[model samples]
Target: MRMGLVYGCAAEDMVTGLTIQCKRWKPVYYNPTKSAFLGVSPTTLDQHLVQYKRWSEGLFQIFLSKYCPKIYGHGKISFGAQIGYCLFLLWAPVALPTLYYVVIPALSLLHGVPLFPKVFGLWFLPYAYAFFAKTAYCLIEDLSSGNTLNGWWNSQRMWVIR
Candidate 1:
């Protein structure tokens, strides 16, 4: 049977690639000394956000549909591949928790309600550690990937926006 790119998806490339992988075909990656392809990136924040939203929604749609990696990919793909697909596909649903974390804390603070333990409390230690560790890890990862501090900050901002 002949295989082609899947249609009717905002992220057709991603859907097609996932489908191909599920068909037990291994993909090849070739990295040469020179650039192989050039593409234009979204120039403005609006354009970037729009593109991101579309891609994320498409991934979420797949997750909700029968094509979910954990569902359709079961037995067809390796465990690690299914996990990797799930991580990317779950991006949109992650926004709900992010929203709750951002908005609830602020609203609680505004109402003089403490949503977390005091800084000196034992429970605070875990929260503090998690926050600092995640921040540090993200910073290190961004820097290691050749991104500047500003770039890391911008990525964090974009994460919240998305």
Candidate 2:
């Protein structure tokens, strides 16, 4: 990890770097750091949009690159941890497919059409529940960590952009 500084949008590249290091050699003791003095500087909505775009784009770039989690991260970490980390890493790219699915239901509603044939049998329910469950889990974690209303609101806004 010390060979290079992998800092970029949302720190996705940094995560890859650290994961690779961990795969090669486990740390005897790992200390995750936080800063009480650190805070995000408030900016205009346009600036926030630009920042989000940059972050997602950076993550997407990493996803497309040779350093992708599946390519370099699979055997390095525990299987479950690797899967979870890859899912998190792929979040931004997955947003496009998620948007398509959501928009179809929205468009069907707008057009006053049935969501699907009654016999179609809610096949998407499990997937929807998984998404919701993950979201709720993250929100609960954030709240338990003393997140403020502004922090929650900001995170929601960023999620929408994603």
| Best-performing candidate as measured by TM-score | 1
lDDT of 1 by residue, 100-142 (tens): 8899999999999989998999899999999999999999999
Query: In candidate 1, what residue range of length 10 has the lowest lDDT sum?
Result: 28-37
Off by over 4 Å in 2: 1-4, 7-42, 116-136
Clashing pairs in 2: none
State the displacement of the C-alpha of residue 162, model 2, in Å, after optimal TM-score superposition: 2.9
Q: Candidate 1: which stretches are off by over 4 Å? A: 1-5, 143-150
Q: Assess candidate 1 and give its lDDT.
A: 0.86
- What alpha-carbon RMSD in Å does predicted model 2 have with respect to the real structure? 5.1
Per-residue CA lDDT of model 2 for 1-162, tens digit only, reads: 444445554666556465556557544444346646466854777888777667666766666666666776766666776566567667677878988988999999999998854544687677677888987887888888778767887888767755
